[model samples]
Target: MEFDAVLIEPRRAAMIAAGLWLDKTADDYFDACLAAHPDALALSAIHAATGARRDLSWAELDLLADRAALGLRALGVGRGDVVTCQLPNGWEFVASYLGCSRIGAVFNPVMPIFREHELGFMLKHGESKVFLVPKTFRGFDHEAMAEGLKPGLPALRQIVVAGGAGANSFDALLSNPAFDSQRATITRDTRLGPDDVCQLIYTSGTTGEPKGVMHTANTMYANLAPFAERLHMGGEDVILMFSPMAHQTGFMYGLLLPLMLKARFVLMDSWDKALAARIIEGDGVTWTMASTPFLIDLSGAVEDLGTDPASLRIFLCAGTVIPGPVVERAQRVLGARVISAWGMTENGAVTTVLPEDPAQRAAETDGVPLPGIELQIRDREGRPVSGPGIEGGLFVRGCSNFGGYLKRPQWNNVDADGWFDTGDIARMDAAGYIRICGRSKDIIIRGAENIPVVEVEAALFKHPAVQSVAIVGYPDDRLGERACAFVVPKPGQTLSFEAMQAHLKAHNFATQYWPERLELREALPATASGKVQKFALRQLLRDEMGL
Candidate 1:
């Protein structure tokens, strides 16, 4: 947990000298914005199920954060503590994150869809001090689930629910009048700083265990400023973010940068294209940052409804390379330019096309790296690779680089020179633009949500009938990829796809992590050294399924 090991003094001083690390924290900026324009609209939260909306001005939002901070302090929480929040997009999420910042607690936002199978390990691994959740979201009682998990998590001190009754209530903490005296005391002394770890987001790992990505405010701000400047965003632009607040895509660009820009941002609980169209038309939304599916869905909805998206300007797509036809359709129908981007949980937006990049350019490449970031392709021997036709592993190192993985220091993967292997095979053109060809890592990114292939394989291995298993990704037009599981049954045992689903469900595996297609083999194709040849399986999918 000693961040000094990752962010040494020399790199910190260098980044600061290069103007990449702004010494000021988000807490500092939020306080300044509150003082400068207390009544300016800061947040708009929409309820997807009930079609209700809530808007909060600067003063209201800041005061709620202040109260939440004091209430957290009232509990055993203190500086450097971890506060895990697993809530959908709403004011509660915003307040919880800001509250953590105000009191110098590290915010760990988890995906709302994660069930007990995933949450049990994450809560324990994070050493979570205080846990926050909604009483019931999408008809699942998160509070009840957390209560079920409490006994196993010795570090967890409290579970506060948003719509719960009794003493453990999030809204009660926000509305507590007793904490009003310190409404303006965010500037008070605290053991936190811009360089201190502020966010701990978990990302899928190739080794079957989720890695906690640690980041400081300065490290995060380094990417946000350059990305916003490249896209030409400002206060006048309104953003609608339907991606879950937990994902880094929404966490950094959705919540953090919007507060820094002092812009009006709308947070949707779910991805309802109809509701998205309504909000776009009603609120004059000008931009958004999501994955390819969102752009396709929004454009299709806008075209179907005949809504005039004159105010909409940029649709930033990440995680997948969008097709040229999709980009042209979005441009023609939605009246917006698609800005292709690429990033990871280890870092925020690293590469993105410019605001004026044409559809062909956007589709052909993932664009150049953002300022203060460097991307290079190297061969298997770790030497720099050259030219357009040759493919090599992509490595990135820059000011926007993350500190390190939380507990697994060996998993950090940064060389002494600060270069981190991105596990991607890419080709670079003469224009210094890199197009991702393939990934060396075993991860399936289905619709921007990463499914850890090794983790799923590990879980499926527990099945009695499963003698061997390998998870592979097959191309999907809309989601970019879908998972297919290849299994070898035990002697005299026969397995059906339905049986596999039943076993996974009984084991409490996440529904999203389950394989859509299942294939049974007498034995998997392996190397002489007994390593499964996943490329053969992927190729089999390409040839057999005509994917």
Candidate 2:
């Protein structure tokens, strides 16, 4: 796909001026901090299982990253190498990612839940030279998974495990005297341009194999500036990060943004609402970001424990839709605004509600496009759509837009004119505010009328009994496709399709939009990032409906 056709000329020019220049690479971001604040606390990693905490200063983090880079280089890792990382959220993951960037290697973050099926495909397709994983996390043996995949993945040259056996433990490499000496020789080189690939983020393949989205160092930086500006983050702010650093939201908003602003970040190995609240109340965390579910969990915990939400100033939601009620409760209970942002792995954070915006506006819309971002709604024929209240496929172009996918350079998703197709259906108001309706693939068509699944799902979520819900299209001989809902009721609550239909009907939803069939389950299948696995739910429906 070529992107030139959709590129908004003014937005492209602004992005060029604001985003980091190609001459300044990823390593330069870290180096600036080490030079300015050598003794300030840079990172604090808390082990969720063990209740252990490790702190690293600006100088210490730089040293550790350099040593890790040197150790990988000694094992023949160099420029353009793809390094697959499967460790949980912790200091090891942060250091290793920076180390790879320092040596011009592409960082590939894989979710820990991915086993042989997903892991094998990424390893082979990415042509990974080195893999950094934990020995064991939450009873899953990562070492065994790597060994199981070794036979099929011949390009894997080294397996560096963080905690388990049969591989080089990360601690030993950092402590090795030989590697320590090599760190002094490592220097930041400008040869690695901003356009060069810095990370290969694999999209959660709901359709088939995951595609490797190649993002550059400048793209990463471009994604962070608007977030920092909107939240009013500065060097004095302390951030608490519980999201995985390998994912785009975590890598950009949680980790890289803090580094860019020279702010202190507290990292947790896993998500625990109680622990996260304590970090906010006890550690003086001023800013944080996570999915909507996490915010719900945190709010519930706060209500149960009666904890005061005084320290937290900004609570941002990404990767998923933000429920209106959740946003209202967060503002009332936590005294922090719940801002929802939209983006994909291909582009970092693109659109977000500003912190100062009215709560009702933030809840109703996805907010305006961030500075340097050009957003457009286009018809199927690729003509730009004008006016308000009309939905079309969203096209985006800016400095933050990625060059292309990794390895499969020919598989471009951008148009020839430089506009990247977002695959999401959206509408632009006369004021230029963008509101996402749903994914084009996710839209349910009934008798030639498009039913916004997101709108239906959002309405269903407002029910007190509904814990989680997913709306998917089920094939129909008459209508082409009809809406089917899979619902997980809250514990001790009983719900049925009839009850949900009545509730939605009261809200003015068209009767035809009501789900024809509903499946009630104990839990909904979800990706590591907490998105509903609709494809899995579709298969479940097929078995039940006998389609």
Candidate 3:
């Protein structure tokens, strides 16, 4: 189907020029909102432990961000400087991000759980001049970790602690009386444009060292516009943000989208299914985004609490595939549409289920491309794949697509025609419904037949006893490489290889698809974002099986 040749027509020069003039830059999105609705509630951060809510009006948020930006300027931070932040989902994170954006500095938000090994790499790669971190969160001593790694990170010039003693407090930095004066003097000349780099988001590093993805303001803004339009979000909508703002989904959909639409944002420090449900029911949260695991946890808790789950209108699942039954259950029980999205850190949010899609269609596919986005499935030789149900590598081109990795120019995956290779395998139906097969690198070669691990994992998830499952290729002398299943059984359940095999057999999965070996664990190792750490599981299998 030569999808690119047919589907991706070059934009008219006049329309391109019009878009360039009308597009909102990161600073413009914030500044215009503050000017238009100064008293509107822009942010609400609730501390789950104490149930204390911190609300910020648009004026208040602007003042704080401006002050923080002035403070950063005083510290020699300027345009193009990278400021890395490691804080929980809170008002401080928002302030730091906006403060950086206000002055054209690139914001680099690292996950709070990242230790020195991961932190150092991001710091060096982004050439971050300053770091903002929480001192302690749930017993993780970030201060100690930062202090331990400070000597090795030569590019890191300053450290500001959001909380804790013996460090420069965030409040102190913004307390300067001259901050307001500096903000008053701030001009549009210092504002970041749509094309200017706004952030450097690092990949999850499932296969190798994490790459720092560079995104411009236009890339992120375009990613949110379609979602905002499809979801019908407006100033009255209240978005509850539980995901880390470091990742693309949280930054684009949860944060930037709200700001652009002039909606209220509720930020949660951590994810507690019960607390999340309460926020939705009590505060009238309209939208939220989380992984499938989080949705399962919240649905179970809502059932246990005997509370109706109709408060939230939009529930989005990203970062992984959504099982069919999970979507069905969510729709039946919660009255909220389960929107399965397909995107990566490089391209904020690309495809999402449209509201008009049939329930069965939504369950089977990842929906069509967002407006102004183009998708193509190509073979290994870079030729387009034709016909329905044919799986191949997915390539995408759109305004939302990021330019390239920061510093590491060699990792550019885009072709000469500007289409970025997504490293994911997917198939498109005649109706344009896309189904992700698996990651190109994650495909398991069993003898000569290619086994899509995602298909097997999805089939296993249907088992009542299986809470989570990861399929990895284990080295085997006899079969070259064999599929091994790492299963996390539901609480109070025990699953053996024989039992799992029987379950798969009953589910009508191919006999060869049954895992050759099974490893039972109380809990699956997961990233902070709830993605299964398949590489870690593979290592554990290698050690246990003595491969």
Candidate 1: lDDT of 469? 97
- In terms of TM-score, the best-performing candidate is 1
lDDT of each: 0.86, 0.76, 0.76
Which consecutive 10 residues in model 2 have the weakest lDDT in total? 1-10
Which stretches of model 3 miss by more than 4 angstroms?
Answer: 1-22, 175-178, 205-207, 442-547
Kindly list the per-residue Cα lDDT of model 3 for residues 26-88, writing each as its tens digit: 677787788889998889998877788889999988888888888888777889898989888
TM-score of 2: 0.79
Best by lDDT: 1
150-266: candidate 2 lDDT, tens digit per residue: 888888988888874433878766334567766656776712556677778776423334678777666767767765787788988888888777777778777788888888999
Task: Give the lDDT of residue 475 in candidate 1.
Answer: 87
| TM-score of each model, in listed order | 0.97, 0.79, 0.79
* lDDT ranking, high to low: 1, 2, 3
Q: Indicate the TM-score of model 3.
A: 0.79
Candidate 1 total steric clashes: 0
